[model samples]
Target: MGVRVIGPLDAAGLDVALAPFLNAQEPTAAPYVGALVDRGWVAPTDAGTYVLTQEGVETHAKLLERIQIQRAAVTAGLTDDDYRTLLDLLQRVSANVDAFASTLR
Candidate 1:
């Protein structure tokens, strides 16, 4: 899924906004921003920032709705306890992978 823009933002601001969600640095995020600009999902401002076009906003909403539906479908029949256990296991797997990656570095 593409990044969602809430308002007008510069590249540096976008990098920061996306960091937690994407683990992306400015250089990485900038290209995606450019792609959005090219797609007409976002427009460059006179001030050298970008703002979502009306179409972008609508598309983002639809994307979010689709994600919600997918999440619901994936978690169907799972109780709260089951969900928590799944999350915990996923976190453990992520941690293990991070540890192994650190070794390679």
Candidate 2:
């Protein structure tokens, strides 16, 4: 991921940015943003938003690359049919969980 990929830098924006890795709630990203600022990975702008520093961009790219590598390794022996079957099973399980959850609501 690059700075361009992240788009925004406010807490709300960060919530979206961190969603994939953290599955964080919208209000919870503030602490994560603060941590990023403290680490010099991001800088607060006069607009009260943040932007990725050069180091942040570099780090994000590295992390994304590493994830890609890991994903490839994990799926190395899986065929396309295997992937489709896995996806279908996961979707069915998710739907079942959602149905169960709705009952508790």
lDDT of candidate 1 over 17-93, digit per residue (tens): 77744541234587888898899889999998889889988987898989988988999999989999999999899
Candidate 2 colliding pairs: none
Model 2 per-residue lDDT tens digits across residues 1-105? 233465546766776666644531244677777898999998988887889899998998898899978977987899989978988998799778767886886
lDDT of 2: 0.77
User: Which residue pairs in model 1 clash with each other?
Assistant: none
TM-score of each: 0.70, 0.62
In order, what lDDT does every prediction score?
0.80, 0.77
Error of 2 at 43 (Å): 1.2
What is the lDDT for 13 in model 2? Answer: 71
